[model samples]
Structures are given as C-alpha cells and as structure tokens.
Target: MRFATYLHDGVTHAGVVGDDGLHALPDGATVLGLVRNGLPTALAQGTRALRSPAVPIERVRLLPPLDPPTVRDFVAFEEHVEGVVASVGDGAGVVPEWYEAPTFYFTNPYALVGAHDDVPVPPGSRLFDFELEVAAVIGHDGTSLTPAEARDAIFGYTILNDWSARDLQRREMKVDLGPAKGKDSATTLGPWLVTADELEPFRDGDGFLAPAMRVSVNGREIGHDLLSNMGWPFEDLVSYASRGTWVRAGDVLGSGTCGNGGCLAELWGRGRPVPALAPGDVVEMTVEGLGTIRNTVVAGVDLPPVAPARPRPRKRAR
Candidate 1:
C-alpha cells in the first residue's frame, strides 16, 4: 500500500493512499511512526482510525513520505563511478576497496524538500545536477545484520534525487575529504513511499528488483535505466551500512546515482555539455513501483558579500 505525509486545509496529516482518496491516520501520526512500530502489520492495525472524510489526493500538498531519520547514500553503480572518475581527468580508476565493499557518504537530512517543492540553487553554485536513484527506508532496529535480515528490515521504497552542486563537490573531493557542503545543499524525496509487500513480485529469487528508472528536465527525457544495473543489491548495502552499528527505523539508504545518463555528469562524460539548472527549470524523476517526484529550481537567497580580510601584522620578535 502507498502512504504519504501531506497538508490539507492548512493542517498537516499522514495517510494511506487508496483509489478513492487518502485514508488519514490519527492526528500527528506520521509515516515515521509507522516505521518505528513496524510496517505493514502496524500500518494495517492503524487503519482502523481512518480520520473522517478521506481527502482527495489532488487537494492536498505532499511532503516527504517519511520524516527522515538519517540519510546514507551509497555508490553502488560502477558505471556511475567511472563517468565521474573520467570527468575530473584525475586518472583514478575505481579503487580496489570500492569493489571489496559498498562505499557511501552521509548527507545532511535537514535540507530535504518534498515533491513539487522549488529548490533554491545555493549562492555561487555553478554546476547544478540531479541524481536519479531509489532509496529503501529502514523499518526495524538491528546491528550488524545478515543480508537476509537486512532485506527484511526494508519497510518501503522511494525515489531519491541527490541534488548536487558539482563545483562545490569538486572543491571538497580534491581534499580527499568531503562532499559535505556540496551535497548537503539539498536532497529531494517523495511523490510518496510504497511498502515492500507491494513490491515483492518484482524482487526476483536473487533479491533484486529490476525497476525501470528515469529522469526528465522541463518535460524532456534525459536518462533511463533498470534498477538491476546496480553492482550491489539494497540488502548488501544495508548489511554493509549496519556493520557493528545500529540501524534504527526511519533511516534512509539510497541506491546512489544510476549510470545510464541519470546524472548530467554522465552526459558530460559522453561529451554532452548540458547547461546547469537555471532559475525555473523543472526536474522530474521516477522509479518503477516507486512514484514520481518533480521539483523546480528557484532563485536562491542572495546574501550580502563577505568583508575583506585584514592584513597580517608585521613580525615583532627579535
């Protein structure tokens, strides 16, 4: 079943998406609450409330399906890594350690925007890009879980658009340290979350879902691929992320950027010089089974310039 967090008549609500409309959960009960209580089972039990008249989906404003706990985005696509490695002309091949385990970076959770929200390009951002990927929301508590256990912990899936500022990212990555200021600028999730039970048929015996994914800019298709292209499965990523660490409900794990030109960097690697996002450009992404999320680029906060640095004092010691 599908679920969403939304605002209607100036009030925020959480509910299950049905053909008729959205069946509301009790006041203040969020999808995050459903994850903490255990998905499907707890959600089914909670449906008994069905807060008064179901609101038509179109009448309400959608928010990120879950109030994100923490976000960890993993680089699981070799195709994507190769494109980026080539773009920089660093002569760095995919590292040996990368092949040995799932590699990832933590991103800020506070900058999240929901479907259709306009993201302001941060000041001085020159190379704006969108990453098309899928994310699994953790529903249970576990530490150092087995792959099978990790697979079971997945509550649902949603599309993740890890909006990136290439210029800022390049500056930090050169130090071999961070994607922080670059990545933390913004991250988009939604259109809503679909429970795992709804996607069981798509997961083959190998435990991978071969969902068709794509992204579009201003109504023009830019990239497409199958989720099966990932070098690693979501379960492998979860097991790796939970190594000797606690993964609580509400944590999000992304499939990283899918290569088939899902990101502008990949297009550039192939000699397509697409311009960065200008004000008012709309970007949309969709993953099979998981719904589509569309966001618009908006004007940024233009703050006053910084003061000039003072000259250093002359040496005085003798």
Candidate 2:
C-alpha cells in the first residue's frame, strides 16, 4: 500500500493512496500514530476506507510520511563513500570500521519536507548540493534485535533528499568530527510511503531488493545505480542500530546516498563540473518500488557576512 500524509481544508491527515483519491485512516489519525500503534492493523482498516469519500490525491499538499521522533542516516554504500573521499581528496578508502558496523548520525527531525516543497538555498552556501537516498520507517519498537527480527520491524520506505552545503561540510569535516552546520539546513522525504508488503515482489530469494535508483536535476538525469550493491543492507543497518538501544516506532533510518555520483560533489570529482542548486531549480529522484520526490530550490534566511579567518597562535613551550 502507498500511504501519505497530506493537508486538506487547513487540516493534516494520514491515509492510503488510491487510484481515485486518498482513503482516510479511521483508527489511526496520522502516519506516526499508525506506526506506534500497529501498522498492519491500521493498514488493514485503512483499506476499507477506500469506499468512503476521498479527496483526490493530487489536490492535497503532502507532508513527510511521519513526524519521526528521531532520524538516523546510515552510510551503507561503499561507492558513495569512495566517491566523496575521492572528490574531497580525503586520501583514504572505505574504512575497516565502516565494514564492521553500520555507522549513523542523528539529524534534526524538524528540518523535514515533502514532495514539491521549496527548499531554501542556505545563505552563503554557494556550494549547495543534494544526496539521493531512501528512508525506512520503523513500525514496531525493539532492542538488540537480530537481522531477521529487524526485517519485521520495518513499516515502509520513502525517498530522501539530504540537502547539503559542500563548502561548510568540507571546512567542518576537517575538524575530524561528523557533519554539523554543513547538514543542519533541511531534508526532503516522501511524495508517498510504500509499505514493505508492496515491495515484496521485487525481493529475491536472498531477500535483497535490486532496484534501479536515479536522480535528475531540471528533468535531466545525472546519476543512476542499483540498490542491491550496498555493502550493508537496510536489514543489517536496522539490526546493528538496535543493538543495546531501543529502535522505536516513528524512528526513521536513511540509506545514505546510493552511488558514486548521487551527489554533485561526486560528479565534480569525476570532472563533471555540475553546478549547485539555484533558485527555481527542481531536483527529483526515483527509486524502484518506492516512488519519486521532487523539490524546488529557493533562497533561505540570509546570514551576516562571514568573518575572516583569525591568525594561528604561536606554539606554546611545555
């Protein structure tokens, strides 16, 4: 089932997406509510609402599938890491630690967006960029779950566009810590959430999904890849994340950028010279079994002039 959260008549609602329109969810009010309660039960009930009066899906303004309590983005693709390190001249290959565990970082949930929304180009971010990926929404809560069990906890999947400020990211990453000011701006998810059941047909005997993923800017295709190539699968990432901690409902996990050229940085590394997003530029991504997410760029809050770098202090004698 394709589920979506949308605004209508000044009210926000969650429902099942249908050919004619959207079917209201009776027992569960919102996507998050359904995830926390019981996604399967809520979905079953939602199917019956197909007969009820539904507003045409196209007319309503969509919101992020859920208001997640926490959003964790994991680096699962070695191709993406290799491309980034190459582009930035990081002088290192995929680390051994990356292969040992699925490392992730928590992002600001308040920075969420939906399809067709206007994304702001952060002030002073002349090197703005986008990362194409997918996000998994947790349906049931669990801790220290095995990979098999983790699969059952997954509620659905959706497209994720992690907006980036490349210049800021480079300057901050030199500190050897994780991305902060570089990535706090915003992230786009949705258009619609495709439930796990809906994607089962694409899974192979090994339970892996081999779907073609692609990204485009202003209707021109830039990068494409297959989801099955990730070094760490979504199941592994979820199970690893659940270790010694609770993976609760409405906690979202993102499959970091899919391939070598999913972002402009990678393209630039490969000598493509792709320009950064500008006002009115539309960026779109499509993943098999999921859907597409398209957004427009706009100017955001302006910042004060950047201060010049301070002089380095002389070494102190011990």
Candidate 3:
C-alpha cells in the first residue's frame, strides 16, 4: 500500500493513496505513529480507511511519507563516490574499507520537508545542488541484527533529494568536523511511502533494489542512474547501523546520492563557480515506483532594514 501525509482545508493528515482519492486517517495521527505500532495495526487501519468513499485525495497536498524519529543517510553508492572524487580531482576512490562497513551521517529531524513544499536556499549560499536517492524506513526495532534479519525489518521505501550547499560543505569539511552549516538546511523526501511488498518485484538477481532515478532542473533532465549501482544493499547498511546501536521503527536510512552527475558538483567542474539559485528556480527529482518531488526555491527569511545612524553628538564630547 502507498501511504502519505497531506494537507487539506488547512489541516495536516495522514492517509493511504487509493485509486479514487486519499483515505484520510484520524486526527493527530501520522504514518510514523502507525509504523511504531507495528505493521498489523497500520495495515488494518489503513485498509479500512482505503475502503471509505468519503475521502478526496485530490483536495490534499502530499507531504513526506514518514515522520522519522531519526534519519541516517548512508554513502553506499560507489559510482557516486567515484564521480564526486573525480569531480574534485582528489584522486580518491572508494576505499576497500568502505565496503567492509556501512558509513552514514545523522541528519536533523526538524529539517525534514514535505513532498511538494518549497526548499529554501540557505542564506549566503551560492552553490545549491541536488541529489537523487532512495531511502528506506525501518519497521522493527532491534540491534546486532544479521543481514537476513535486517531485510525483514524494512517497512517501506521513498525517493529523497539530499540538497547541498557545495561551497559551505567544502569550507566546513576543511575543519574536518561537524556537518554544521553544510547540511543542516533541508532534505526533501516523498510523495508516497511504497511498502516493501510492492517493491519485491523490482529486486534484482544481485539482491539489490533497481529503481530508475532521474533529476531535472527547470524541466531539463540532467542526471539518470539506476538504484542497483549501490555498493552496499539496504540490509547490509541496516545491519551495520544496528551494531552497538538500536534502530527503531520510523527511522529513515538513505541510499546516498546516485551516479551519472546527479549534482552540479559532479556535472560541472568544482573549481569553476556555478550560478546561485534564485527565487524562482524549480528542482524536480524522481525515482521509479516512488513518485516525484518538486520544490521551488523561494526567498528565505526577510532581513531587517538597516537603521540610520544617530547624529554625531559624541564628536564634541570626544
């Protein structure tokens, strides 16, 4: 079943996507809340709602599918890693050790954005970029799980766009420290959370998810990559993350950026600065089976006006 969060008549609601329209859930409820209660509860409630004839999906604005308790983005695509390295001319390739263990970064839960919301370009950012990715939502809570067990723990999948401010990222990385200003602004995800059962047919012979992903800027296609290119599968990454750490339901695990120049840094030379995003730019990212996410860049917070300086009364006193 496809699940989503949406806004209608100025109220946010959780719902299941149906052929006719949205099947709205009860007030003060969410997809994440349903997942935490376990799939049986979710399925039972969701299926019942879906059968209702009163709900209208077309009247609502789709939000991100999962309200994650925590979000961990993993770098598991070797093609993306290699492409980034080549763009920077750092001569750095995917290390053998990277495959030995899963590597991920923690993201701010509060920065989560809905599927059709505007993405605010961070203030002072001159280099804004987009990444096309696939992320999974965890269903079961556990630790030290094996790869086989990890697969069963997956609740569903969604498309994600890991937006970046490349200039800020480079400056911050020079300090070899926190993600701070580099990635804190926003991450766009979801039009729907497609259940694991629905995606089973797409799993390849290599046991990897093989969704087709594409990214476009202002209606022009820029990048295309296959989800099957990841070096570490979702099970491997989940199991690795669960080692010495507890992974609970509603937690999101990203498949990192895809290859074939998904971002500007990879497509254009890193040394040559690119045009900054303006107030009207639109970025659209899509993954097959999972729906598309389109975000418009709007002017950020308004700045306070500069006050006129007081008359120079201090000049005589000095």
Candidate 4:
C-alpha cells in the first residue's frame, strides 16, 4: 500500500492512497506513530480505517510520507561517487573502503518538504543543484542488525532530492570534514511512501530491488539510472548504519545520488557553477513504480539588511 502525510483544511493527516483516493488514518495520528507501533499492527489498524467514506486523497496536500526522527543519507551509489571524485580530480573507480563499509551523513528531519511544493532558492545562493535519490524508511528498532535481518526491518521506500548549495559546500569541505551547511538547508522528499510488500514484484526478478529512476528540468530529461547500479545495496547500508546505533521506525536512509549526471555540477564542470534556479523553473524527478515529485523554483524574498554600527570616538591616551 502507498502511504502519505498530507495537509487538509490546515491540518496534517496520515493516510493510505487507494484507487478511489486517500483513506485517512485516525485523528491526531501520524505515519511515524503507526510505524513505531509496529508495521503489522499498524497496517492492520490503518487498513481498516482506510475504508471510511469521508477520507479522499484529492482534498489533501501531500507531505513527506513519514515523519522521521532522524534521516541518514548514504553514498551507496558508486556511479555518483566516481562522478563526483572525477569532477574534483580525486581519481577514478570506486573508493575500495566505500564498498567494505557504508558512508552516510545526517539531514535535518525538519527541513523536509513534500512533493509539488515550491523549493525556495536561498537568498545569496547562486549555485543550487538537485540530486535524484531513493530513501528507505526504517520499521523495526534495533542496533547492530545483520544484513539479512536489516532487509526485513525496512518499512518502505520513497523518492528524495538532496538539494545542494555548491558554493557553501566548497568552502566548508576545504576543512576536509563536512558537507554540512551546504546540505542542511533543505531536503525534498515524498509524493508517497510505498510499502515493502508492494515492491516485492520488482525485487523478484533478481532477488534485489532495482527500480528505474530518472530526473528532468523544465521538461528536458537530464539524468537516469537503475537502482541495480548501486555499489552498496540497501541491506548493506542498513547493516552498517545500525552497527552501533539504534535505528527505529520513521528513521530514514537515503541511497545517495544516482548516476547519469543527475546534477549540473557533474554534467558540466563546476567551472562557472550552474545557473541559479529562478521562479517558474520546474524540476521533476521520478522512479519506476513510484511517482514523480515536481517542484518549482521560486526566488526567496530578501530580508532587509541590518545597518552598520556608528564608529565610536577614540579615547584620549594617558
């Protein structure tokens, strides 16, 4: 079943998407609460509630499908890594260590925005870019889960765009440590959260999940890749992320960026930096079996600058 968190009549709601429309969950409850309450039990209760006549998908504004307590985005796609490394002249081929272990970073849960929302270009930012990715939502809570078990712990998957500010990133990475400020501003997620059971057919072909993914800007297809191309799969990433940390329901794990030059930074050398997105520029990202998330870029309103303090008179020397 596909699930979503949406705003209707100024209130946020959790519901399951159906052929007719959305079937709303109970009042004051959220997708996170359902997951934390255990997938089986939650599904049982939610499934029943979805049959109500009052709930309809057309009347709501879709938000991120789940409200994660924490979000960990992993660089599990070697194509993206290699492309980035090549862009920075950091050598070719996958870094061997990346395969042996999963590498990830944290994103603020509060920064998440729903599909179709306007993504504001931060003031003073001239180098904004978009990354196409797939993220997993955790269901079972555990620490140090094995790869096999980790697969079962996943609740579902959703699309994510790790919007980046190249200028800010470059300055910070010079310290050789973080991708923080550059990435923290915003992370776009959702259209719907698809359940694990719904994805079983796609996984059946090769006993692994390999969805076709693509992205476009202003109706021009720019990048595409298959989930099969990932160097480290979701299960491996889950195992690594859970090694010493507890992963609970509503926690998110992203599959980093995909290949085929999803962002302009990879397609064109960052020599001049990609043009800043302006109001009315539509960006669309899609994954097979899942849906498309379309966002329009809007120029943010500039805040008034603070006035400079007046200079004080020099004190007399004694």
Candidate 5:
C-alpha cells in the first residue's frame, strides 16, 4: 500500500493511497508512528479498519511522508563517482577504498521538503542542481545488523531529490570535509511512501530492485538510469549504515544519485556543459513503482557575508 501524509481542509492527516483517492487513517495517526508500529501488521488489518471516507487526491496537498530522525546519503553509483572524479580533474579517479565498502555522509534532516514544495537556490550559489535518487525508511531500530536483517527492517521507499549548490560544494569540499552549507538548504522527499511489499515484483535474483529512474527539467527529460545499476544494493547500504551505530525508526537512507547523468555535475564531468538550475525552473524525478516528486526552484535567502577563518600557527606536541 502507498501511505501518505497530507494537508486537507487546513488539517494534516496520514492515510493510504487508493484508486478512489486517499483513505484517512485514524485521527492522530502519522506515517512515522505507523512505521514504528509495523507496516505489514497494519496491512493485514486493512484500510477498511480506518473507516474514514476517501478524499480526492487532487484536493489535498502532499507533505513529506515522514520527518526522519536522520538522513544518510550514499554514493553507490560507480558511474557517478567516475564522472565526478573526471570532472574535478587533478588526475582524480575512483578511490580504491570506495570499492571496499559503501560510503555515506549525513545531511540535515530538518531541511526536508515535500513533493510539490518550492526549493530555493542557496544564497551565493550560481550552480544549483538536483540529484535524482530513491530512499528507504527504516521500520525499527537496529545496530550492527547483517545485510539480511537490514533488508527486513525497511518499511517503505520514497523519492529523494538531494538538492545541491555545486559552486559552494566545490569550494567547501576542497578543505577535505564533505558538503555542509552547500547541501543545507533543502532535500525533497515524497509523493508518497510505497511499502516494501509493493516493490516485491521488481526484485531481481541478486536481491536488488530493478526500477527505472528518470529526471526532467521543465518537462524535458535530461537524465535516466536503472536502480539496479548501483554498486551496492540497499541491503548492503543499510547494513553498512548500522555498523557501530543505530539506525532507528524513520531514519532515511538514500541510494545516492543514479548513473548516466543523475545530476548536472555528472554531465559536466563528461564534458557536456548543461546550464544550471535557476529560479522558476521545475525539476521532476520519477522512479518506477515508487512514484514521482516534482519541485520548483525559487530565489534563496540573502544574508550578510561570512567572515573568512583566521590562520593559526601550528603547534607541535611535546
């Protein structure tokens, strides 16, 4: 079942997406609470148990399905890594350690937006971009879990647009740290959350889902790829994420960007210079079986310039 959280008649609600529209869950029910309670058990009880009338999908405004506790985004696509390395130059290439394990970075969970929300160009950014990816919502808490166990802990999937400020990211990452303010603005997640069972048919013999992923800008398709092409499957990503740390209910794990032009940087890396996103441009990301999320870019906040860091003399340990 496709579960959703939305606003209707000025009130927020959690419900199940169906043929008619959306069937509201009991009052006070939230997607986060439902996941904690167990998606399969709720499915067994059926939507009829809610007894709320269906509201036309068009009438309600969709919101981020779940307000995750944390967000971990992984670069699991070899092509994306290769393209970035090539574009960055300096004779860079995919690092050997990247093959040893799935690597990820934490992003701000408070920066999340919904499917139809407006994303702003981060201040001082001239190269705004969108990353088309998919994410899994954890169903329960677990630490140091095995791959198989991690797979069973997944509640559902949602489309994620890892909004980026390329120019800012480029400069900041040169300090040997990952993205900070460059990715602090907004990350889109929604349309709705489709339960794990819904994607069962797409699973391959290798235990990975094979879903078609596509991204468009203002109605023109620019990038496309398959979810199955990732260097590491969701299971391995989840398992690796849980190592020495806990992944609790509502924690989100991103599948990173898909290859074959998932973002403008990838294309730029390949020597295909595409224009960056500007205010008023619309970005739509679609993943087969999971659904689609579309967001519009808008002008960002302008603040006072930050002062540069002062240099400090090096001190040696005695």
Candidate 6:
C-alpha cells in the first residue's frame, strides 16, 4: 500500500493511497506514526480506516511523507563515484577504502521539501544540481543489526533528490570536512511511500531492486539507470549505518546517486557541460514503482554574511 501525508482544507493529514482516492487515517494518524508501529500493525490499522470516505488525491497538496529524524545518504554507486571523481579533476579516481564499506554522510533533516515544491538556488551558489536516488525509511529502532535484520527494519521506499550547490561543496571540502551549507539547503522526498512488499517484484535476487530510475530537466530527459547498479545493496547500507548507533522510525537511509548520469556533476565530469539549474527550471525524478517527484528551481534571497572567526595566536608546546 502507498501512504501519504497531505494538506486538505488547510489541515495536514496522513492517509492511505488507493484507487478511490486518499483514505484518511483515524485519530490524526501520521505516516511517521505508521512506520514507527511497523508494517503489520500499520497495514491492519490502514485496512480498517479505508472503510471511511476518501478525499480526491488531486485535490489535496502532498507533503513529504514524513519529517525524518535524520537523513543518512550513502555513496553506494561506483559508476557515480567514478564519473564525479573524474569531474573533480587532478584525474582522481575512486579510493580503495570506498570498496571496503558503504560510506554515508548526514544531511539536514529540517531542510526537507515535498515532491512538488519549489526549491530555491541556495545563496551564493551557481552550480546547482539534482541527484537521482532512492531511499528507505526505517520502520523500527535498531542498532548493530544484521543485514537481514536491517532489511526487515525498512518500512517503505521513496524517490530522493539530494539537491546540491556544487560550488559551495567544493570550497568547503577543501578543508576535508563537509557538504554542509552546500547541501543543507534542501532535500526532496516524496510523491508518497510504497510498502516493501510493493517493490518485491523488482528485487534482483539477494541484491538491490532493479527499478528503472530516470531524471529530467524541464521536459528533457537527462539520465537513466537501474536501481540494481548500486555498488552496495540497501541492506548493507542500512546495516553499516546502524553500526554502534540506533536508526529509529522516521530516520531515512538514501541509496545514493545512481550511475549513468544521475547528477549534472557526473555528466559534467564526463564533459557534457550541462548548465546548472536556474530559476524556473523544473526537475523531475522518477523511479519505477516508487513514483515521480517534481520541483521547480527558484531564485534565492541574499542574506548578510556573518564574520569569520579571527585566527588566534599559536604557541608551540614546550
């Protein structure tokens, strides 16, 4: 079943998506609450709730399915790494340690937007890009879980667009630290959430889902790839992320950018020279079975700068 959080008559609600329309869950049930209770319980509750009348799906404005407690995005696609590495120049390539484990970074959870919202060009950014990927929402809390256990912890899947400011990311990482302010502006998750059972038909053996993933600018298709192309599967990404830490309900784990031109940087790295996103440009990403999310780029306002920290006098240890 697909679950959604939406606005109707100036009020926010959580509902189950169905052929008739959007079935509102009782007692102000939220998508986060549903996932927190795990699928079996949520499904049972949702089934009973469907007896109520549904609102027309098109009439309500959709919101991100849930406000994640944390968003952990992993670089699990080798082809994407290879292309982006080449783009960053000095002829750098994927590192050896990258092959040893799934690596991820925490992105701001508060910076999330809905599927159809407008995203602003981050302040002081010119090289804007969109990453095409998939994400799994954690169904329950767990730490140090096995791959199988981690897989079971997933509530559902959704399309993830990791919006980026390439210029800010490059400058900040020079100190070997961040994608911070660069990436903190916005991340998109939605259309809605599809239950794990809904995607089982696309499973590739004991590996990743082989859903067809695509992204476009305005109306032009820029990239396409299969979800099965990831260097490490979702279970590994989740298990690795949970090592020595808890991943609770409403926490999100992204499958990272896909290969074969998932982002403009990878295309630029391959010498395509596609222009960065500009005001009014529309970006739409679609994953087979997961649905599409569209966001229009808008101009950002300039803010006064904060003073940088003054360098302190250094004293050598005696």
The candidate that wins on lDDT is 6
Tell me, what's the RMSD of every candidate? 2.7, 2.9, 6.0, 4.5, 2.3, 2.0
* TM-score of every candidate relative to the true structure: 0.92, 0.93, 0.89, 0.89, 0.95, 0.95
Model with the higher lDDT, candidate 3 or 5 = 5
lDDT of each: 0.85, 0.84, 0.81, 0.80, 0.88, 0.90
How would you encode candidate 6's per-residue C-alpha lDDT over 153-177 as one tens digit per residue?
8889999999999888887777776
Please list all clashing residue pairs in model 6, or write none if there are none. none
Q: Give lDDT: candidate 6, residue 145.
A: 90
Query: Any runs in candidate 4 off by more than 4 Å, and if so which?
Result: 54-58, 88-94, 204-206, 269-276, 301-318
Ranking by lDDT: 6, 5, 1, 2, 3, 4
Model 3 lDDT tens row, 1-318: 888988888988888888888888777889989888887888898999887664575567777887798999988777777666555334466667777777888988788787778988776676777778899999989999999999999989998888777777776666666355667788887988888888888889999989888988788787898889888889998998999889999999999888786777675543434455567888898888887889888876655544666877566553
Those runs of model 6 whose alpha carbons end farther than 4 Å from true positions after fitting are 88-90, 305-309, 315-318
lDDT of 4 by residue, 47-148 (tens): 886677645656777888887999999887766776666453344556677777778988888889989888887655667788899998998898999988
lDDT of 1: 0.85
Residues 194-232 of candidate 1 have per-residue lDDT tens digits of 888777777767678888998999999998988888888
* lDDT: worst 10-residue window of model 5: 44-53
Off by over 4 Å in 2: 306-318
TM-score of 2: 0.93
Better of 1 and 3 by TM-score: 1
Strongest candidate by TM-score: 6
Off by over 4 Å in 1: 49-52, 88-91, 304-318
Task: Work out candidate 1's RMSD over C-alphas.
Answer: 2.7
Per-residue alpha-carbon lDDT of candidate 2 for residues 1-318, written as tens digits (9 for 90 to 100): 887888878878888888888877774488888777787676776777777788987788889888999999987888888777766547486777888878899888999998878999877888899999888889899999999899988988888888988888888789888787778788998988888888777776666777788999999998998877777778888998999999999889999888857888877766677888888889989999887888999988888977988997787875
